[model samples]
Target: MSRAAEAAIAASYKALKEDFVSNLTGGEIGEINYVTAVAPVALVLWSALQTRQSFFKPYTPLSFAVDFLLNVCAILLATTLYSSTPIVLNILLLAPVAIIYALPRPPLSKKPKVPPPKTKDADAENPLPKKPFLTIYRGAMLVVTCLAILAVDFRIFPRRFAKVENWGTSLMDVGVGSFVFSAGVVAARPILKEQLAGKSTALSTRLYKSIRHSLPLLVLGFIRLYSVKGLDYAEHVTEYGVHWNFFFTLGFLPPFLALFQTAFAYIPSYAGLAILLGSVYQVALEFTTLKAYILTAPRTNLFSQNREGIFSFFGYLAIFLAGQSTGMFVLPRKLSSTATTGTEQRKRLVLTLGAWSGFWIALFMLTTNYKYGLALSVSRRLANLPYVLWISAFNSTQILCFCLVETFFFPGVYKATTAKEEKEAYELATSRVLEAYNRNGLFVFLVANLGTGIVNMTVKTLDVGSRGAMGILGVYGGLITALAVGLDLYGISIKM
Candidate 1:
């Protein structure tokens, strides 16, 4: 073979080898979720820019042109992930955090609207109002976040984004895990509430239910693994087996933690359990040859496929337990927090999240530096203390920023930017948009996955340049988003 061909072959082999160790050495990005992090603020800010007349009415030619241009800008900004320096991405993504607080808000009403007197029965039954806006926002975030993460994974974006980079880099792969985990955390809201209400949540019963719930995923994961073999596109063999976000981590978490909660209700906090579990893993690594076992036997049993999907469950379950513990503290305050002024409730929530973020940051540093620690970068596979702390810190901080945008910042911007008489119509449009997005988040997620697969099949992604790849992603994402919104508006909800 020619010398040039040998070098090329060597490069391909190195790339293949990297597929195995990418999680270890990919150099994780801290702001991996920058696109997701900025979305809530962007959505609200965009809504604020709408006029009452145009909000309720269909957009005119000029308005449509302007919105289209701005949306294209947004899409490129989100997907290209190109920056001369990491700090540029940081400043661009973090701009909203600073800018939101600076926007002028409407003055408080001279006559504060009085609530009807709480009768004894009314006080007894304080019904939670249906928060359409928040619901829509979550759905949108899920769809958009899922799309962006998948795009990077498919090599539709910059290569650096598919792995970890500096803290402020947009859409790190590790950060993607946190985004997925956050949804799981949110989904546990009801379970957390049940535990807090002093309900008897037996581990056995929870385990049985979790098994039933996870059975479909068990079937699907195997099927997906098998089906992708003949396809000419990229496929991560381990990803479906144990590495996918929705697989082993989620499968074992509920029942495993329920067992712990059942046995240890006497304990005051999840912190103790987290430390104990982490220590056990750390010690086991010192004493055992499990790493060798995993590398040698890829699919030996149901428990440890890809070595990580199973082992990471311990760390993920810890995260879930911590989430429930957090719910115990956070949900009650959220329920009782009534805002007299726009910022009051939001201020309280942000402060709480900020405190938790700081705590997690400190824990991450301490744990990561544990002599055995600084050697490893943050890992989604292991889901260890450093990984857990890094995700928690970022998720808390970003979610707080999102809350600020939704609660005080965007609302203020809306009022200040629009006339008082147009308020009702503007609200109506925002509500409708939110409801549309909220109604079919799962549908859109599936749609995006399907679209991604189809696009890969239809086009030579390796032959495509960054700009072309981004354009493809844009059209694909736009189509899915539009279809989802349209179907939802027509009251077509494809529920699981």
Candidate 2:
């Protein structure tokens, strides 16, 4: 590593170690934890931005190469250092490094004029209408019915009907329901149109914005699919599983969220209801034979088991609804001159409560599940209420952390730079970190899986002794981290 790069790495490690110590010692570290947690994401984002910006600069290739190398080294260092740490701590330490990279540079002195709001045309008809409470209740009930179907397959029905085969079938049913629900919302253009028209619409425009904003991701996904399928890169493909699925799943989330937003607009506390319902259902599922039946089912024929039913759909839909409902009330609005100060304060207060609720939900999942690794997988049957709650909680925490840091600490960071300027100086720095998350999140994850697979594949062939095996394992860690960073830098795009 270059001296500058080495210094940066050292500083990052110092910060992370200090933060970890503070946590261990029960120090009164407040925002410092938050700051550290956001660092890695910020770094990846900066790296991506840098790479994109370099396209216009003369030294684009060199910039990419340097950033890629730095990221690889950073990842290698992190993996080697934290391999022995607890999984939670390892996960937490990544945030600080990402945040430091995302920290803003000194601002330019010139301030831009704030633009005025556009006037709406008088003839424009509003698309969204106020709905009766029963409409929302019925919608929620439909979701509940779906959950009930899945529950039946999990042996919740009459004892004579109970069988292990029912579990697998239920999983498939739920998966199909999830896909269908996702499709249904994606097709609901008129509802989306109306939601966008209303000034006080409960739905978050940002989710819609992010979905539209991620067109590049879809293109990238197709390109990757072509590369793997057409070019026969399957032989050389290192990170297959982790990269592909996330792109497709994220593509589905926005429209699905929008539909939920519209559906729950009238329900005063839909998120709470969704959480309560989902958690109760999950607890019931856990206390019975549901766990053994669902987890041990054959992986190849997921639909053959009884667990492939509609309740899984309800559980996930509840999560989707929770995210949407939270977003409606939680996301902060960009300050506009027309909006009164009270409006902003009220919004902030709502967001604060929403954030706390999300945190508690996540904490509950971490404590309740003895099967920690099971939840990390992508099985729809495994994606019961607890899984939904946990993932939603984690996802919400990330969003909240990002928003808080950006709004309070990194205010005006995006506004200060044009896309072009950001691309030049900030691209590699930002993009590198975000590359970890972008369209290839699942693909990158698959790479990690492949790393584990490779280890398993070589176990018999290598025939190494215990000490040698340990050494090989250590090297594998470094290689995995390097490959992850390389893939992240090359394929990911950073969004501000």
TM-score for each of the candidates: 0.71, 0.43
Model 2 worst lDDT run, 10 consecutive residues:
129-138
Residues 1-496 of candidate 1: C-alpha lDDT, one tens digit per residue: 3566445545654454356554344533443444444454444544454421233234444543444333333534555654224445445544654454456654533767876443343112322222323453455455545556446644546665554321122345444455444554454566655755778766778788767866655655554455455454465444334334454345556556656766556766765665567667655643454433333333646655556566666667666655554444444323344653324544665677678778877777776664844543454545655666666666666555555555542454222212332244234434343455556765565566667777777877777876787677767756765676578657798753
Q: How many backbone clashes can be found in candidate 2?
A: 72
For candidate 2, the per-residue lDDT at 298 reads: 36
Worst 10 residues of 1 by lDDT: 122-131
Candidates in order have lDDT scores of 0.52, 0.39
- What's the true lDDT of residue 413 in model 1? 23
Question: What are the per-residue Cα lDDT tens digits for candidate 2 across 1-496?
Answer: 2566445545654464345423222111122232223234333343333332332133455644554433333333222232233244435544544554565644435658877335442113222221111111122212222222222222122222111121211222222333333223223333345546664444567466757845655665565566445644322111112134333444545555555555454555546656665666676655654443343333334342324333354565566555544444332222233434433543464376466556646554464545862232122444465445544554345445444433343223323223333233233223332333332433443454445444544454235554554455446534544554565557553341
